[model samples]
Target: MGAGHAHKLYRPAHSPVHALPPHCKIAAVLCFVLAVVATPRTALWAFALYALLLAAVAAAARVPAGFLLKRLLIEVPFVAFAVLMPFVATGPRVHILGLSLSESGLWGAWNILAKGTLGVAASVLLAATTELRGLLLGLQRLRMPPLLVQIASFMIRYGDVIADELRRMRIARLSRGFEARGVRHWGVLAKSAGALFIRSYERGERVHLAMVSRGYTGTLPVPDAAPATGGQWSRAAALPAAALAVCLLGWTL
Candidate 1:
């Protein structure tokens, strides 16, 4: 990925969290999330502990609470789905304020809400500290399929170009007094989308050809770098270690 394609989620900083290797951070986040997922949903204290752990990490990373909260809104759709569970789910109904709700559904909703929120928060924190290219590199280092990593890399690199193309097309439409005010304009919108797809495809072909001409191989070249030191691994492992402790407590308690 091009260095110019820095994702909006990354915040440039000199903190220790930011200094850690990308693969280590990726592994840490994955382990942390797995621990959270393994925890029993009914363990309310466990969830609170998880939140506090994340909060500590956020503070250590110097990520703003407002920034985290704003990005956390990405989970709103899942929250909406979970909200309906209590009302729509059947079996073992409980009366609450003259309305009956399924107890199982209530538990299901809590599960979704608690687990989903924690997962998203962890992801947001990861993104906030790591750049898009770093994430792709991390995946590549972690033995992820090269094809998938390349696809993600290209998507991140060219996503802005595609968005800019869309913006220009919209402007051209507006210039021609083509307002998409109703279903009548659907045909125009569909045609525009089709054209965009064709253009993107053609661009991809050209890029591929250029790479082939430049002696491109099936896999990207890995940079020669020092392996992670024992200290670095321990530091990176700390977050997941704490999370695992919480998971064990949740299970045993």
Candidate 2:
């Protein structure tokens, strides 16, 4: 897989979190998310602890709180859906601030907000600490489907290329004094999108043919990433292990 590009989310740092093998961090984040999801919604304190754990991770990763919070804005849509749940969901009603709200809906909203935020935060942290190339390598190390890994590899590699193409197209349109200000411009935008698709498709065909001529196979060649050591695995497992303890407490208490 190509290791030429790092996604925008990656923050270059020299922290321990960044030093661990990508597969170890990936597995740790996965387990931590599972633990968070399994916790009872009523155990609100558990969620607080989960947030603290993530905070500690961010601190250790040398990722500023502002960096993490700004990336977390991507989850605003989920937050919006959760906010609407209290008004739209059907269930037992409760009164607060002279307004009636469904009791179950409130809990539902909390569940979504708490869990979704934690999940998104975890993902953002993972992306922040690991590069796109490292993530692909991690998935490959974890025995993920080769084809899926290849697809992701290609997406990461060419996403910027496509974006650049779109930017250039937009610049050309603007240069011709074309301004899209209303619904009337939808057709032009749609045609532009179609043209971009065709051009991208042709580019893909040419690239594939070039690869085939060079003895391309059904799978991409794997990079020689080092496997995690026992100490590294144990260290990486600490987050999820702590999370598991909290989850069990959430269940038992």
Candidate 3:
């Protein structure tokens, strides 16, 4: 993806977390999330410790609490699903506020809420620290399938172009007195979508031809790797290492 395609989630900073190599950050986040997932749902205090660990990392990264909380709204749908679990789950029930709720459902809800929140929080933090291109490079370093990486690269590169194309189509429709009032307008919208797909496909073909003319190979050129030093790896590993410790305590205690 072009440097211009940097994601909005990346918060430019000189903090330790931001300075960590992208691959290290990726590995650390993966390990931390695995640790969180391995924790027992009944270990309520352990969840608190995990939250604190994330908070500490956030502080070190200079990520704002408000920013993180605002992004956490992305999980609202999951939260809603968890909320309904207590009502629909079948098993022994308990009374709360004079309403019967499944006891097991409550545990399930807590499990979802706790783990999902932590996982989302970790992801948001990762995005905040790493640029989209850096993330792709990280995945490449981690030996992610080149095809998947290239696909993601193209998606990031062209996503804005596609959205801009849609906006222009919308404007053209509006100029032509199309208001999209009801089912009557669906046909027009469908035709516009078909046109957009055709345009995108043609553009892809042109790009591929241009690449072929330039002697493009099946694999993209790999950039020079600046693998992280041992010290940097140690620093990066600290985050997941701390999380693992907490996970062990959660399981044992």
Candidate 4:
């Protein structure tokens, strides 16, 4: 995939959505998610509205349908967890379509699925509209622990390099007769993992040295000013606001 489609990762573009400041989007989207998650799952209309709100945000951000689908898929683990909860959690069980499911547990499961899906969508929009670096800056602005932001900044900086290296290693293994299918094969796989780790460690050292040579400071610094304006907050807020409103309406109905 081209960089644009690669992981639906963030980069600055000329799009209107891309012009918004990162912190505002993060705050608004997070609040929206909390609202959805806090709502009762039996409120089915609320969940539907939450899904629709996510779709609307995608459209407003000009996100391609394919990109949104990929983002949605990333929530599969959460959805799975939610789906399993009803069966695994102890509660009053009822039969649905010839399957036993918990009453309260089922509600809890749906709640998790809705919240997780919405959360993932919100994250995708944040990444789509803002550069990865910009998001880190916004994190710092939002007073996220400095140490955490510093670590995240470095990880984002070198994440692609590490990923590329992994791809090359995989390709090398594939070119050889390494079929990843048996116990014996796993030994070689383990060795390869060790080798990959060593390489990554050496790369990190080299990167640190290079940065130091180039006048590296104690902390990663960013531009104090981002172009996101107050207007952008309003535009982004509209989504979560509507979502929350729908949930309230569901409760009322």
Candidate 3 residue spans exceeding 4 A from truth? 1-3
What lDDT does each candidate get?
0.92, 0.92, 0.93, 0.77
Q: What TM-score would you give candidate 4 relative to the actual structure?
A: 0.81
* Per-model RMSD to reference: 1.6, 1.8, 1.5, 3.4
Write candidate 1's Cα lDDT for 1-253 as tens digits. Answer: 3566778899988888998888999999999999999999888999999999999999989999999999999999999999899999989999999989999999999999999999999999999999787888888889999899999988988899999999999999999988999998899999999999999999999999999999998777877567778888899999999999999999999
Candidate 1 local distance difference test against the native? 0.92
- What would the per-residue lDDT of candidate 2 be over residues 1-253, giving only the tens digit for each residue? 4454867789999999999999999999999999999999999999999999999999999999999889889889988998888888898899999888889999999999999899999999999999888898899899998888998888778888998999999999999999999999999888889999998999899989999999998777776766788999999999999999999999999
lDDT of 4 by residue, 63-121 (tens): 87787678689777777788888898787899999999888888888777777777787
Instruction: Determine the backbone clash count of candidate 3.
Output: 0
State how far residue 39 of model 4 sits from its true place (Å).
Answer: 1.2
lDDT of 3 by residue, 1-253 (tens): 3467777898998999998889999999999999999998999998898999899999999999999999999999999999999999999999999999999999999999999999999999999999888899999999999989998988888888888999999999999888898998899999999999998999888888998899987789979777899999999999899989989998898
Question: Pick by lDDT: which candidate is best?
Answer: 3
Runs with alpha carbons beyond 4 Å of true place in candidate 2? 1-4
Using lDDT, rank the candidates from best to worst.
3, 1, 2, 4
